[model samples]
Target chain A: MDQRLNAKDFEDALPCDAPDSGPLRWAPPEAPLAMQKQVLETRTSWADLALVGRLFLSRRKA
Target chain B: MHSHLSPDRPTRLCRLLALSFSLIAAITASLLMAEAAARDGFGALDGARAALIFLTTAWLAWGASLALIGAPGLQRRRAQPDLRMPQPRTVILIPICNEDPLTTFARIAAIDASVAEAGVTADIAVLSDTRDEAAARRERFAFARLLRETGGEGRIFYRRRTQNVGRKAGNIEDFFRRSGSAYDLAVILDADSLMSGEAIRTMIARMQEDPKLGLLQTLPRIIGARSLFGRALQFAAGFHGPVFSRGLARMQGATGPFWGHNAIVRVRAFAGSCGLPELSGKPPFGGHILSHDYVEAALLARGGWKVEVDPSIAGSYEEGPDNVLSFARRDRRWCQGNLQHSRLLLAPGLASWSRFVFLQNIAAYVVSTLWAAFLVASFVATVTAPPPNYFPEAHQLYPVFPNTSTREITMLVFGVVGLLIIPKLTILTGAIASNRVQGFGGVIRATSSVLAEIVLTTLLAPLMLLYHSRAVLQVLSGQDGGWPANQRGEGLLGLADGWRSGRWIVLVGATALTTVYWIAPDLLIWLLPVGLPMLAAPFLIAWTSRPLTHALFRVPEEIASPPVVATYHEVCARWEMTWKNSPAEPSAGMAVEHHVPA
Candidate 1:
């Protein structure tokens, strides 16, 4: 019979309430296209604008 | 002809001699510049200009060195004797991120068919990192249709990661963790990548021949370039790129290049040595190494494995950005990633060559800023120089201007141009001599194409300089250019679009030229080359974005489309009909977003 290791029996397994390493890895967060556009329009800093203003200025929408 | 298993003593001597010659040329230029500076009373600005001249000269010399090393290898072809041993199990991994599924999977199918035709048993895995729900649905449907059409039920697999951790690198790592143990070799491909049956077999056989080889990268030629910018790049890659690659191969030796895709890796070696650990702190400097390919190669080399780039292998192909905006957009991500390698410069256990390669990668971006600074310093020197001192107080015997005479300056300029142009000419000459110019439409047409490439690149250099300078500035300011989906196969950029994308470039160019003119009109002659193209940047971009006249820059690939490219087109044609008839509803259990883990 194949034995299954329960959460309590495993060396590193966690309980249901225990916290895990946040996301396991850092991925560039994804958002909807609208949100991405909004962020590009608003969150982009002045330094960034001065450097690559063309990309931001060419945005089709606000 | 000759065995190139490893660069022999004479080849090594040739590399050293080439380096020495480059140094001598650079030193001669620097000495002349220094003499002129000394005559000008050698101020801080003059000193800065001198430094810039030295760095620029050395950089050009490196290219010259590569040309010297590559010239001899031009006609030398590595013999790949047929392997009678049983072929190894290989898995082709295609990682897609929001690409057109119909085309992407269609390419995969074509590659699969090629592999099958070669009698090479290989499993195909389409790893999806796509985030959009609609795109994911389309990918699944397209993939299902692919399996059915190709009869690749068990051989081909599609798995979309719920969380695309660490972007593409993470996606590959995830696959490795789950089921990588079953395969001996993993051939990685980008969505746009295609390889012919012969190229595939050669790569696998080469790896089999050298058990110490951990990774083998191919020099993928640019194909499917439609727009004028694309065609120019395609021409350069098909022509100049190979000679340059040969030199690069000789230089890299056991430590080699991995260009992320169209390369094969030893599965176990990659699984063990390339488990990337995130850098401490945030990005633009840290976090997941965005330029993972180079670092992975370095890691493999560090683990006592050979990573080599075989430039002689043909038929590997990929697409390039079609226009300036698209090119700049792609460059933004790469610039950030390469700059991020600064943190790993002194990381423990890296080979010395690996560290130097990292520095070279960093310099690839940093040199733009230096060039920009040099230009600024030159402007300052021009504007601030004291009027020509024909008489040096009462001590001078004859009237002499502190600044370099027009003739001397002209000579210096010509010297720099020689450094830049001579290598390219040598490569062209070598190509003709080696009977390799036939593919590029014979000697006459190839010569014309090379001249056109030079002209086009000269006009495009300043724009690239500005783009790279700005990118370096952004990276320094801690701005992370998050991974963006590559925009491919676009046609000519509209005038308005080009203007919008290149407005800042024109603005800066115009402003700089006006400033120089206002301060010192005589220097305008010196600045025209940099200024005029920049002022007309938007227009120039719009012009180059369109089709070239009469296939003026037509590369051999465009002149005679390869059979694989034709096959790809045929596959796409069939796909158009299949897509029209297939039902539109999302298949059951195919909701990509729903599979996301909490």
Candidate 2:
């Protein structure tokens, strides 16, 4: 959840030594920690698990 | 200066030979034990027991083999550190999550001062993934104070992410993508990590001279332990950590481990190779990788780069959980992380050794469950075994049915028990041989510490086994252990809390002992060592967590802290004093400025 930042959120981030002009130019743009976001490439697939699942389903049909 | 293939051939050959020996010996021992069981017509229960024995035995022997390979002496580094070289563009990155802001920032201030004192240069960055607004407010003020005290305006940086994407690993990756290309190298530190300037200088020099070295991991000695549990953990790590690491280093060749902190990594290489892809599954086996350090190292190795560990690099330190509950909590996360590697056992394009390392990581936790299963199987086997032929040969004069398997079974049990001793003995021998025992209070103290450690671990092993067993079952059942912030500087567990957490364990211990006594009185004696401790779980937990003011589990660090550590302690004290005396809370209004001690 992206927190709604406000005046109180930055309430006491007052700089002790440096000038307070910068709006805490702290971070670069946000980057997602998700699996690499290439739509087709980022599928979380485990080949072995998939194989076992197939075998289980096949057995059930029989 | 660092040539990868020219020198490591002998090390590789030795590793291969030892691993082969481990595998063959494990198989042989298991087969012999299985045959012994089948001597009197093996049942399905016997088969299951045999399998469990094999797994546990393999796990034990493999561990002992590492101690065999790792000489107790410091591992020699290939790249001769050239301190004359200009300091590279590097940033010491400390990624924190809801950590105690005052102490964590104090470490940074001390480290910054130490770096200046060494006449070296490196920037420090604190990447905060703290979610709570109140904690974030505390963190920002803490950073402001650190900057003012260190006069590190342009050099020091602080950032907090509102949307915490990937936890620590993601936080680090975010740093690299944002500012990593600006630096040639980066030193990764946990919130509790504190490294001296000299150590920083050495790592940088070694990294600069070697073009192919991707990461260099330092052995972060545990410091600042107060409770008996904390000190015992510290002593064990201080004594056994290096020898095992040295052994691990020799076998690793080009591919080494990344313990997530107190290590230097080539910025570009890590940026390129370690953009970790989240796993496909929902949790436990998927989403973000929990043990990202191991995977990162493997990825670096797969990318044809050298990753290494240099245990001789001292002055790097971190603190641990002070009590049993905290330790178990931290351990549960690690347990889940390792077990999740089952999905990656056959991941493509990995170094065979890397995959094997993954297996060993998984086995480290799974072996506990195997031990639990073995005990259950043993009980069932013993109970179901044909009743002793009381009337064999028309009422034998003595009711002794001539126990035949006693010697064989004892020898097998003895062999299994003896394997656990070999590694400890080997490490001690190496420590004594290399005259490295002095750092751990010389011969007498070190020996006693070892004995104390053995007792501590023996008493705690069954309790941990129960925890590990639960952790494994939970993970298998799709329970995800979210990345919880480490509970540092807090470890006192009251009797009630201990009982609340461990009542099931005590019940299990009592039930097992009672059942065994009624059915097979002889086996009751064999189970006493493990069973008794579980029965006293709450008491042991409470007692070990109490603060100790003794000289029992002292490491060299406790004898006299390093200059950096001393400085950190001073800074932490001042910060705490300032916080206590502050007239008003930050929310209230303007506050008095802190005056740091010179």
Candidate 3:
């Protein structure tokens, strides 16, 4: 029963993203929010062993 | 012998025979002197007798050593293992200074294509020391474009130095720092170095089999020798030099020379021990060790790694210096670097094998200086001293003063002649026996080329001796032989500069010989084999780069052609394709570009 960490949980741990935080902002507001969220989700899925199995199967067939 | 001589040519043949005999007589005289000197005193001889005796003895010993090494019996024993196998992943490093990028890139591309066709996995890196940003950018762009077009983008990498701290050594060190950990082994190549893909595969297989072995240095056969000077050197290196190197290998046992390139070294061993030490003194003999190979070999040996020279490995190649001035410039640095080994000879904690090598390095300089002095002293003594009487004064303890016996003299003549000619005969025999004769223009051309090479070598020997002697003097006088990047193309002789640089030895030897000749015509005639060549240097230099001579002789074709590589390529190609298809990291593409076809 190993605990799994999601992207939202990781981002929330950062001090700059906290609700009370001020005077510290590195990210630009105009950046594509949907693309960024998709990228994070894709990265999170890669950490799963099932994804590795699928990738190997695809490579062998190719 | 008499029946073969024509009436007109009898005298010429006789002179040749006499010259042969005199060389032997000179050697015997020296040996007898050494024997006598050892019993009573060597110091008792007048300076002239001493010098003549020493020079003759040194030449005789060296010649005899060469003869022994080239003996058929020795040749049969010097066979290498037939360890040919499929190629392994190879990293080829071409270390360059501010050389022409176009020529360098073209050569690299040619090698790349050859390797690719052979199907060998190769990583090529052009390690450049050009500090100028513009020049660096130009090379980078050229390399990038070449790689892209050739489909070698991931296999070729070009990096320039921000700081050229240690020259060639520093450039290589930087590469090792970045990417050395990735490759199996690195083939350190000079800009002028070019080896066949098959030869590379053979070297790789040999390395793969012998994991304990650290390096395998191939004897580079000279190619592209367009100039007369270059051609002569090419001939000597291809024909006579191998026998001497075989002898050196025999004597060196485990501790052999690493001649920088045309060789392979284990990556880990090189990284661990090849970091050179900064000398505590000034330039010429000190500062950053100019000739790092010798010291690197020593360091490798000290670290319990084996460094050996395999002269039998074929197809390793390099270009010779185009002319006399270019050669002198190169020799000047070599002289200083070799002289610097004197300090290492005294260093402690080194293995006995390494110490012996260090001694040999130092002796390379010392012996040259000694021979130079001996040459001068011989002439001075011959002039001032009275001639030797045929009959000697009797001593109370001995019945007669020991003089050279007629029997000994005859034996000496045969021995000296055997020493000079037997090595060439052995090489000819080896060429035939090995069936390498078929590759060249068969037996006839090989035999004729060998004969021509001997005559040319004999003429050039004295000139080289004179040049080396001057280098020795320059090193001893504390004049720094400024390090120049090796000259690539042919050019006219800078006559005034050449004269200024070489005048000391030339003037000294010419004046001494002239004075000696005036006093003793017999001695002068006896010394003509050596004297005539030195006197003919200016003419030799002027004609050294003549195109007509090169074309007529077929000198380039005789020496420069790569050995047959069909079977070697087949084996390597099979291995490389198999490796590529296997699951591996995404190809970085840096490794194959150095060998891409131009």
Candidate 4:
């Protein structure tokens, strides 16, 4: 309920003026957004079903 | 300047008064119950039962007394006026075992984004002690994807230990030994932990304001609970937990609770004092301390460093186990950890309060076994004892009627119930009066949620008693609960799985019920409350685990989740796509050095 802790206040308080020199530095992905979305959808469904199925079957077996 | 207790005598007096009230209530209730039992012609066993109940209820009363004393504090939002001081660099350590990397990294991303938005000088380290091959692969991919999504390559670092020596405690020590010098503070977090940047900054600033403050823990609200059990817990935590927490803080004085995660600690203090030495024994009783948090807090307190849990600090969040079985599993692990404290009670150089706190934690689990024993004793008394005699023997010509304990017994029950329910009602009344019930969907919804939580927990208590009793027994029998990754998120628990987990409870419940019925039908009513629930354990576990049933016990956290919760969800949603598209095969190590980040 603190007034200073609202979402917009949180978003606008970015603190990244320091020079970036860390192991996380990497080249941007070349994959297009459309292709990425398509791959992501297929993968998401497959992964979701896989996890759900595994958990469900395992519990049932127990 | 940093005395743990107050210099003012009145404050100390208040503390003593609260402590005395708890003691008196427990003593008085126990005596009354014992008196009632004695009148029924049941003797020593009943007396022992009454004594154990006294110890248990006394502990509960102590907690209730603290909550009552601290209830007013909840209404007056403890303000932390922006101190506008230079913030210390913090290393947010997210320790992971074999958990879903997608979910873990999503939480990290959320925390990282919050920190970035707040412009706080904090770095996140995804420290994994995960030994599973598949989980490690997913972890690597997830880390790389997280870096890509947030462009936080250098800001977020990932490391997986090959030899998990001491489990989570060791994993953290590895980080402190390697890179602890770089950061002034370390904010430890669990895999499911998501804390706001503002909250982290506040913690760091508060630490800066007080040089002797070694650790500051936040009361994290349970978010993302999508099951009936989880929601009930979530609701209770949001509504009832804080008042009790405030009371505990008051009782704790300077030596407060350290729940391991969603907390910040001075790196120097933690490194100097909290290097946990394994107990001289084997599994369950020895090796690595499973409940390292309490000991760590005690160590800090012993070193004259203040450890505190500030309930007023918001934006800290974590997920609860979604099902009763999962809850029991986690409790089993905690049971081993807490029971291990029995050995530490006599641990040299611990402050008197620290020793007492250890006993308190131990009692939390031990009380379950005590309750089971009390029930058994009552059953025995009912079965073995002769029926009450309305007429006296030939000593008197007139029949002298026996005294009924109905009134005394009723009063004793009411007293115990009042101790449990008063604090909750106080919190509700305070919230409604102050118009702060809006966050909980107004008074009606809030009251309904509270009622639902009470009902849910009442049904679950007997099952928990069975679980805790078994856990305590397992630990006593030298069985160790190895560090297991908590099962988070919404998932269905099949009836077969529920039965597998709860069959013992069912067996115990059935035995208790049949024994009571065959022996004394009058006592059947009393046993039914506990017994029926135990018999219904499987169904409760399976039914409450379903996401659809969550609506029945909806909490404020779910109804109006904090920004951090929403942020976590959003980040996870975005990452879900990336995780799906991520190559199963490790991409030549993702261009990272295997060693710890410099």
Candidate 5:
């Protein structure tokens, strides 16, 4: 239903700036190549995906 | 805003008119049909028989429509995914008035363990209204020790109000005012609530998903329903309760129900919108809101926030009353609280959907009254009407005698089947699909348990109906059925007290059925629908435990495993321990602490 947020829009909404200073990092390296491709193709925001991905990773570590 | 009820007034008037018209139509149709039957030399006996069939069919149709619409509405609402996520910092408030501290502490510890396992960091506040300095100190120290033992040292804290103020709501508000700014959300828990890790995580995620979501309530399954009556209640709740709630959810959507405990709310939402308005009255409907959950949900909805029930969510549990009287005691307070919502039905700005939910609550009360009336009517008809004809005067009376329409019979059969069987089938399906049947010693044992539960519930139904009827009468008459804090013990009822409270229903039902049977021997078969259940009440109540029922059923050893019995046993043990450890003295000092200042 709703439009997927873009990187710039997500960045503006973030409480703090990202540590990365590159042009724009859009996909996680550890994600499967197909998933990464879909992320890029779908215009999924990096921040929103990163937050969920990070939470999952933390859960696994715990 | 000018006081205007124009929009709602017209709708309310229309609804009343529709109800009146339908009732009048039903009466007219039945009377005319009876009159026509009488004129055809079909004697008064035949007319009475025709009337009975028509009335029964009408009752079945009414019940079916309610189930079809109401059940789906509840289900659809519960199906919505919770969107709230975990905030970094939050407060979990557990309000205790005069409850057992150890029991409360153990449950909190269980919840604390579950939350930590979910990796959600939050502070715990034990808001005690116990005034005694010594007892309060003891409870606080016990909580502190339990927290540290469980690796939650700084995260767990305690607070006691010097003054009780406005009871539970005030106790929470006091905390919010003092330390409200420190947390983004608050999890309000009852002293008895036991939530699992996954449930907590899901609830937090739901809150995170929707910022405007004020509350997320989980349907609580009964925990310690050990007695026969209690077990029947447990099975009913664990089985049929979800279907009815799932139906309610479908109708209410986001603005469903808030059942007080086992739910989470946003801090800002609580502070801004959930402050309860005191009613100008006395006991039963007044003082403080006895049942605050529904009113809180209404307030949250009024303040433009979503409040919902999620029945699919699991591991939120509460205990059921062990016997009929205990249930009546609890229901008396509930009846008053729900009846109070009659006023809220007309409150301004509520979504029409929420008002519908309020109406459904009232409908539940109405059903009790209607059923009682039907029982009385059936008794009167049995006494006054003559026996059925041995040889029908109109075997060829085509449309007049209309060979008991298959549609009506099927509708009646299906309604009974759906209410009794479908719920168990649903749970069995869920368990099988999830592969959680391992705990119950495979398929056969689980099936037997379902069968046992059905028989147990059937026998106990008459008793419950009678208890609820008395409760309805008390509520209607405005009697103060004071809060009989739930009995958490294994103390069996004294036989005399049990008979005094329980035997009257059985006597009345049995007496009516016996009268029907004596007058018309052929009617004996139909009387099973009412008679057998009443006769089995005492036996059912006596053998309601898992161990006892299993033994009585001669369940196979493979199915009646130690683990299954142990689960029930542990519940009993906990209740007994709670009772045995109650404070020795009146604890007058503690009483003073919980006394709310007028």
Candidate 6:
């Protein structure tokens, strides 16, 4: 729709999919979570432990 | 109000502003740290610290700019729905996974009754993915009890799957695979979700009016909080959430957010676009998509459907975790889901903003880990740093310590703190100016609530950093935090429970503090804000989990409960008594508030 489509345009094409049409529209790339031991441990949990803290407001999860 | 989003929302301008603010913040942080480090010859450690500080600061500034950009629309009035348009053929979907039966059913009953009163013609479906046979049996019994109460035999449906293949997403997919074609739209909600007829009506009208609008999400106000932690969260959602959401809306003009529950989706569009593909392998990254909502939003955007959020609708409500332990446990699962989304950042055919949203979601979780990394670098840099060269010249006696960096460091501290807080203070000011604080128990009480929320959240931030960091590690190591049932009505935890959950956290705090004191005592003050809280986390966790009865963090819902919220509790109360008084055999007419069709 280009996001250029407006609610006022009722004449626009309205295409619908079959209920059983199951070709997945999206797929994952290779395991992006897979990371090097050095990076994971250092970035998230250093050689021994990671010191983590900083207050910035955001709750993309919630 | 979520969307004043037009095709001409000036999103490019907002993006430019966001970019400029982030760059400025990042450069400023880097330069300030470099200036401090320059007093002693800057080492590799100093360089590492500067880079980490730059990245995290930029991320923080990006979040701040959303508030700045969206603050103006806080008090803007929403357009009324056209009542004359015929209500669309809709089905209200309540997806549950091993949730408590009576309570979950009670919420459904309230929604059903509300929709009925609103004169909306819709079928209600209780789509249960409960794998436990006993819980599934209880759901059926409670569903029958619900049917008897509402007298909605055929119009309401309850179905449970033998195998919960894709979890909640799969559960909804099962619905579409069976009866999706009969409805024009589907209102998807979680077990904890409840919406007023006004909110429901507004979403439906918006969808009906806009054919290309695939999904419309509403900002559900948190309610029914009995504990201090939950109440504080409720206040934040009611107060700060709107402005942030407005910023989100302004940034995301057409391709908006879909937060799993409390959203309406056009059946054809969703069925066409959101068939999530399991990744090529096993747990964590290579399996059923855990954060299906965001992906679905992205997919719809890919398919050219306008996804949006309407924050103006007032009656949407959901319950938050009443305590810290429950919140963190839930966060563990969400953290994994969000991490899994990093795979889709490069997915084919996604809208630009959609890809950015994925990036943003991953960044939200990853930023904590990055900040932690910055702290580690700073710690090592400070401890390993050589003694300052007091006499850089050939002359021996003259010491050369510069004090200019102290003032710059102070200014940097205030700048970072201001970036974190000024947006919220501005929102409160806007509220007071717009008389928005009237619903929050007047300006004094509302101001108190914001201040209290700030203090409580600041204390809890360290704990979240640890939790989030651990979660990222677990996911990276291919650990799957399985789908666990959400703990409702269970926020109370003993000090022992807190200790059991956070004992390692205590060790971490102790180690950092002790190490800083031993190796770099001068930097101890910098670490105390975070480290001290970690040390006392057990006590904070246990204490905050306890129930409270005060008006400090009072939200509007506390002042005047919505009709749907009132109805939910009423239905739950009546159903509970009837359920307790009647026989356990549900099919043998265990309880009936009204005559149910045989």
> Weakest 10 consecutive residues, lDDT, candidate 6 chain A?
A33-42
Q: Best candidate, DockQ-wise?
A: 2
Q: Give lDDT tens digits, candidate 1, residues B500-590.
A: 8888999999998999899989888888898888988888788888865434555666667766777777787777665545445332323
Q: What is candidate 5's lDDT per residue for B1-598, written digit by digit as tens?
A: 1123122443344344434543543454455445434433455554554555345434433333333443422233334354344354666788887565555666677677667766777778878887555565445544543544455544666667889876777787777777776776777788766776567777777788777778888888765444566655665565456655664554455676888777888877777776666665675655566666777777777777877777888767766677656666677677777776775676666666667667766655555555556555544544555444545665754433323333443454454455446546666666566554554545676667677777666666666667667777777777877655545543346545555555776787788677777876655675576677666555544444223343222222223322322332343345335323433222332222221111
lDDT per residue for candidate 6 within B385-495, as digits (tens), equals 776666878967878785546776777788888888888899999899889999888999999889888899899999999988998889899888888777787767899
iRMSD for every model: 20.0, 7.5, 26.3, 22.4, 26.1, 21.6
Candidate 4 residue-wise lDDT at B175: 82
Task: Give the backbone clash total of model 6.
Answer: 3
Better of 3 and 6 by lDDT: 6
What are the clashing pairs of model 1? Answer: none
lDDT of 3 by residue, B35-144 (tens): 53333234434434545554544455554454455444465344343334445557899988866454466567766766676566788888888765444544554464
> What C-alpha lDDT, on a 0 to 100 scale, does residue B340 get in candidate 3?
80
Best candidate (score: lDDT): 2
Per-residue alpha-carbon lDDT of model 2 for A24-48, expressed as tens digits? 4444333322222211122245987
Give lDDT per model, in order.
Answer: 0.77, 0.79, 0.61, 0.76, 0.58, 0.78
Best by TM-score: 2
DockQ, 0 to 1 scale, candidate 1: 0.01
**Candidate 6 segments exceeding 4 Å error:** A1-62, B1-9, B73-78, B83-85, B402-404, B585-598
Candidate 2 stretches with Cα past 4 Å from truth are A1-62, B1-7, B28-32, B73-79, B390-402, B584-598
Q: Over the full model, what C-alpha lDDT does candidate 5 score relative to the true structure?
A: 0.58
Worst 10 residues of 2 chain B by lDDT: B589-598
TM-score of each prediction: 0.85, 0.88, 0.71, 0.86, 0.67, 0.87
- CAPRI tier of model 4: incorrect
lDDT of 3 at B483: 74
Per-residue lDDT of candidate 6, residues A1-62 (tens digit): 11222322211211113244233211111111111111001122353232222212233333
